[model samples]
Target: MKKEILKIALLFLSITSSSTFAQETLDAFLKDQPIIDMHFHITKGYGDNEIYRHLNVDIDSAKLYWAIEDYKKNNVVLALGGGPLKYAKMYAGAERLFWSGLIFPCTKTVEQDKPCEKEFYSESELREIYQRGNFKSLGESMFNYYGIPPADKRLEPYWKIAMEYDIPIGIHADSGPPVERVNKEERPNYNPTYANPELLKPILKKYPKLKLYLMHYGGEYSDQSLNLMKEYPQIYCEISAVSMFLPKEVWEPNVKKLFSEGLGDRLMFASDYFGTVRKNIEIIYNLDWLSEEQKRDVFYNNAARFLELSDSEIREHRKKLN
Candidate 1:
């Protein structure tokens, strides 16, 4: 009878130990998970201060470098957009960063006096830029900032180029931070009217092959964004600034709905601001409603499928940490 009791105790201890070992903190899970950030921007010096100031946060070089180091330590790779590409070039050869060709419109204000022309790259200029083989994606394009609709005539050739190269395009669409948050003097051209997700429908119909993800998951347009994802197999959305900046009550439900509707595989994780990356990861990780598989899909699997990383490539990436 003592031997029987001893055996039962041993079995109970073993099960308890196994259960303890299996349960992990969100941070621990993220440490082991590979993350691909599809909507990252590299800001230089105080260039981003004005925007972040609205959030009452201060940024400096040291903080920025720390964020980059955190990404490297966490096995997070970035699909980098916005530039002065020199900032991204700083981390070149590390293979941690992929560059996106940026396109900005010349129109400086909401007024009609300014003609809409390509500011950063003309069509021909962008072709040369892509020919250099440095850019893996095209944009973080601010179609709303320039007041150009996605189906506008000016952007047709650019879309064709994206199709030709099979390059993914990231666009800044829908309302971002509240307009009152930004200092009007600093961002005089800020226009929320043009930032609607509905604007992209015609463009999606026109370029079915265009690999694109709407940045911010079409802010405040959860229903429309999900419909687009369902209608177009190619459309994907990243939870970036919208996830971090919006009130939790507002953002959490939208994300939950996406998951409940079976859009887990189509969602990607991102922190548009470097400082918020850790917090953003924690936010998603702490959600009790998401299963381990759903978390894995959001953290890495979705991005792997989106970027078309082969099995060997994913294995190699995982092998690096081990």
Candidate 2:
């Protein structure tokens, strides 16, 4: 009878300890941290987009409001958007944190194999469609599947246009299979070779002032991304889907090297959260290898400097925090 009583006490202690630890973890996460999700997407269709479709079956005014509230409840800054270019101005209003938007080069046509449907726009069209008031930067552009070689002359027009406007371009440089399967035997397009830094070397070298963002931890070309970061001080890398997709075992050590090798300030934390924001935030916060200060940069500081916002602006945002 004494042994049974002792066992019950031990179980109670264990449960109490576990509960306390979980609360501690959650508390640490919620403390005074400002999260600016630099890569988020909100489109009208639900489950129709491939990955996110499985997460939500509906997308309407009510659903969007719910989604916005959920993100806001979690202290998310912006939904760095992606979708039809025509709606760029409309979603520009959705940004409550900072002004950022995505321009999917391949979204203009259903034919993914051809060159981008509209490679270069007239000055008037670009201003009308993309340049809505203060939408500061143009995005995480998915270049890998656009079916154009990185070295093609066609990219020059894009370079000139974005450069002319002094806007930074966030490139989706990773390779991957089509999120949509068009053929039974075909594999997804998962190679970042088209964006290998060697191909970009000339363009980058030529247009030294063009602000290029290498997203996805350089995708399949991490080494190349590192080299670009080394060679061009202007180059930056946003850690998004890769951080969330990589398990802790693989990520802890690799991220150390990525930081040690001059990629520290260049690294920005992004959830790539269309569907995975909650999990990504947990994983990033739980990374035992990173110190709290390191996590702070990944969460906020790095992006503030990269985007060149003033100290006053950052402090103003901090003051408005809950």
lDDT top scorer: 1
Instruction: Find the 10 residues in a row with the least total lDDT in model 1.
Output: 107-116
Number of the predicted model whose TM-score against the real structure is largest: 2
Indicate the residue-level lDDT of 93 in model 1. Answer: 28
Task: Supply the TM-score for candidate 1.
Answer: 0.77
Which pairs of residues clash in candidate 2, taking residues 3 or more apart in a chain or in different chains? Answer: 47-53, 175-190, 175-191, 176-189, 176-190, 177-188, 177-189
**How close is every model to the real structure, measured as TM-score?**
0.77, 0.78
- CA lDDT of each prediction against the hidden true structure: 0.67, 0.62
RMSD of each: 9.4, 5.0
Model 2 scores a TM of 0.78
Worst 10 residues of 2 by lDDT: 182-191
What does candidate 1's lDDT look like per residue over 8-71, in tens digits?
A: 9999999998756644455578666887777766444453454343432444344355555777
